[model samples]
Target chain A: MRAFVRALPWIGPALVLIALVVLFPIGVMIGNSTRDISQSGVDRGGVGLANYAEVFAFPYFWPIVGRTLVWVVVVVVLTVVISLALAQLLDKAFPGRRLVRMAVVVPWAASVVMTTLVVHYGLEPYFGIINAFLVDTGIISRPEGFGWTRNPGTAFAWAIVVAVFVSLPFTTYTILAGLQTVPGETLEAARIDGAGPLRAYFGVVLPQLRSALAVAVLINVINVFNSLPILRVMTGSIPGYDADTVMTMIFKYMQNQHRIDLASALSVVAFGLVVAIVGVYLRVVRPLEEA
Target chain B: MRHTRRASGIIAITLATTTGLTACGFGGGTDEGDGGEGTTLDLLVPSYSDATQANWEGVIAGFEEANPEITVNLEVESWDNLESVIATKIQGGQAPDIYNGGPFAGFAADELLYPVEDVTSDATYADFQESFLSNAEVDGVAYGLPFIASARALFVNDALLAQAGAEVPTTWDGLLESAKKVSALGGGIAGYGMPLGSEEAQAEAAVWLWGGGGSFGDADAITIDTPENLAGAEFIQKMVTEGATQADAGSTDRSPLMDIFIQGQIGMQVGLPPTVGQIEENNPELEYSIHPIPTQDGSPFTLGVADHLMAFENDGDKQEAITAFFDYFYTSDVYVPWVQAEGFLPTTKSGAEVLGDEESLAPFLAVLPDAQFYPSTNPSWSTADSAFKALFGQLATGKTAADVLTEIQSQVDAG
Candidate 1:
């Protein structure tokens, strides 16, 4: 009891900081969600779940939510898988390995908005290098013209491409660290035991790097879910299939339309989704702690 | 180490609290100067390049010289996403005293703008051109001062037109025929180009509809589904399909269109007067002439856009100073140079008369009588724009004009 009392002072300061910075703002958001936001400052009213109901009732709400989920899953999965492959390939000592590493990190270092603008203007119909090359090669009979990001399917595809590109460097570095930690002696032993490269990778290296993989997956999941800039700059906040991640939708409601209450509600919903995903992740990975 | 950490934490907390308190203090304090002997006015204007800056500074210097008691601080903000930034500042009660209140004033009027009814006088308001004044008036009160106005005109590559043996089109059918001739000459340019992307597309599309005697709304209700509007939409669709414009017409913005026109890739484009200056700067050899937007029924109609200067609700002395500054702004010394720098039509009758005498500026001034203001005052115009853009995008791809118009009308009505 005395020891507990002695530790309370240090813990109290940390708790206060967390409560003020995080919990208080969340409480305020919840309180705001219950009020009506007319021209006047937040109307004090007792409306239980009405804002949530309005959000659900809107025709665009469900489709946007569904699209956000698909966006996060696709971006997270592709980024992790491709980055893992690249990290493994680059983990070995090879010619120009340092240059390849630098090349991989360059996109991450550059501003995402600048990158999107380059892509947008570079792919523009009249002056874009893509069209110029296509014309030169005679692959296209006529100019495919513009509108690459105009269609929903192509827009969504481009969004995933951008997300993956921006995410690759960090994910690759994380997985590369994991690859280094997998004991070389164990791999040599597996090779002497008649296991091929792919077999050794699956049986020996994979299990060893599970913790690093967990961290990479979790980081990518949170990042892809919260990412706003790539989608925003690329598609201009169109609320479905490309620019309608949960974070972007919440921001659009708050800033573009000035619907702070609905934005708060959407934010709370997004927060809940993120928390649930993290919770499941922790639970699933709990058994691997001993490793 | 423990003591150091504790001290660092204290410093962080103190810094945060100080910042928060200072922000709160600024918000709560009166933005308008007290009726003291000396007052400072914070004026927000859109950012400009060095030449435009020098011109504005010259005006500011003259204003300051005239009113030594009042000091003006110029804050130049970028135009992109500026509306939302202004809204946030106003909502937070830290907006500048005199800010750029352009086309977004309608949005501001809906609980955003501080009412300026008391600050402005009839005599002061009378100094502006009637069309400019009327455009700034919202709900029967002048909440803004009309500063600059721009109009869209058809820019023709005279060499290309003469080479193709075509005259400048005055009507819709004539334009189509000219377009066909220009396309056949193989200059890698379209005969016409309009920004079909989002809000701009909807706005440009509306000009054609209105020129053809169609209406989107009639003060109280949606009216865009009429046959005339459909015919206008169909004409745009035909232009895209027939290669009179590029298939990518839905995505081309003003910049790309201007680039192609400047490069002599396109024979004709609908652009503003500023484009003429740009063409002159980029390619002085390109022979181009400006004319009014072609009408469907052989009448002239052009799209005119205006910027407004507004006075927020403030102290009496600040109001007087604002009024004086605006009076100084309208004088030929300040107004003429500004018009030339911005490449916009002058807001004063005298200034417009002066610009009309210049041969290069005459075409833009000539079309002023036919210019129509944007037909919307809705706060949700941005939303409407995107919806309209989507419909037009579908139409440009291949949807029937009638179906798109019906769908758009329904959507606007529902919203």
Candidate 2:
């Protein structure tokens, strides 16, 4: 008790900040999920679990949930795999390596909304620059038919590509840092033992990268799952939640439906689902980490 | 001990500055609330064009010059962000004194607005078009002041029609035939620009559904699944399936499609009066003619849309200042120029008389009398509007008219 009391002041400000910034909003969100909030956001008293019931009963709820899972998995998996290769390349000594490294940060340094907007207009069916280029190069027959972000199927695919694009720099940098810490002697040892370069990388360096990979994967999963601006700008005008994740769907509830209570309810469910997903991922990753 | 004393001094200074800043914030709030010689009002409006902010600022300049005691703070938001911005402000207890937006029945239902009479003089209120004023009524009491009115008309590319050897269409069958011919010309040109996307699908739905003698019912009910409405939806699906519309019509929004039309890539589209200005600015050489929107039975039809300016029930002190602002804004000298600049029809009698002579405004003006409106006075109208925006695009994705309408009907019913 005395030790904890002595430590209190050092941690007190951080505790207050978490309470104010994080815990308070969560408490309010859970409270709002139960309340009968008006479209204009007037709190009309509590309705118990009725708002949650309505959210469950929403017609597109399950489909959107399924799409969200696919969205997170595809984007995060692609990001990690591509990032691993890029990190290895970036770690090697090369001429103008620093310049190339700076160039890689462009997508990350630029605003996500601005990046998505550029892609959105670039894929316009008529007169888009990218569409024109494809037509000119004989890659596409014409510039009028390829509305890449308009159809749900193609829109979802393009959104995944963009999600991976913006996710690369931070992820690559993380793994690259992990690569720097791997001892050169170890790779030399594996090479002397008659292991091929590929075999040495997979068997030796990869295991040392386990913690960094874990951190990268976990953060990417959450960030990709909760990503809004890419999908919002890409498929926002496309009607229906056919391509929506829970984050965008929750925005629809508030922006389109004007039902704050329902949005709050769905938010709670989304929060729970994210926690469960991350928990399961951690449980699986922990055993691997231990090994 | 000396280092500890220095830390305590820094903390003392920080606490003092924080308290000082908090007091200044409170002081500013009270000054805004005080009903003395000088008063400030908040005005929130959506950007109609690049000129929207300038026009409002001009009005404020004139109003303030005339009435030196009242000051107005203006916030201009894009049409895309206006609703959510207003909602956020209201929820945060910082609703603007006056907000210009589309649907106010939701706000009116919540008793968040002052009645029209409370915010405008009797003469100012009497000057408004009776039809528009009635459109703003909720429970037989007006809540919104109609700020701008627009009626939709069919804009046909004269060059495209001539090239295709098709005359301008008057009926639905004639339109389909004309569109097919235009599409047949085939150098990346669309016969018709069908925008069933979320941006303004409700407007396009209004054009077809109303032309087919259907209504979106009223506050208490949704009539979207009616056979008349179904016929309209089927016609849209027919247009999509027959390759008459641009590809991926489901996700094409009005603005980008309008850009295509301006570029002379689209043959026909339903357009507003402002579309003429856009065409003039972007591609003045493109020959186009405006006509009455084609109907199933060949009767005259047009979709009328209006955005309203409403006063939130702010503190009691703002009522007089708001009325003064409204009266100043509606005066013919001030209102007509702004209307002309924005290229929208005026909601006041005198402003219309002044703008009536302009050639481009004549076609839209002639059809204003027969224009059908979305049931915006209905509290459920926003819900129904959003439903159309989100679901009508499904028709392009091979969802049947009946299925889409049934889904929309259920959404409205649930609301």
Fnat by candidate, in order: 0.03, 0.57
Runs off by more than 4 Å, candidate 2 = A287-291, B1-37
Candidate 1: where are CA atoms >4 Å away? Answer: A1-54, A143-147, A237-262, A276-291, B1-37, B48-55, B104-117, B120-123, B163-167, B184-188, B218-228, B314-317, B376-392, B398-415
Model 1 lDDT, residue A128, Cα? 76
- Per-candidate DockQ values are 0.17, 0.33
Clashing pairs in 1: B145-B309, B189-B265
- Model 2, retained fraction of real contacts? 0.57
Q: Model 2 over residues B1-415: C-alpha lDDT tens digits? A: 7545643443333332222211111111213453577988988899989889999999999999999998888889998778777776776677889999999999999999999999899999999999999999998999999989999999999999999999899888999999999999988998989999999999999888888888898655667889989889899889899989888899889998999999999999999999999999899999999999999989997999989999999666689899999999999999999989999999999888888889999999999999888889888888899899888899999888999999999998887
C-alpha lDDT values of all predictions: 0.69, 0.86
**What digit string (tens of lDDT, one per residue) describes model 1 on residues B203-296?**
6777678778886663234577898787888888777788787545665555666887897867778888788788888999998888888879
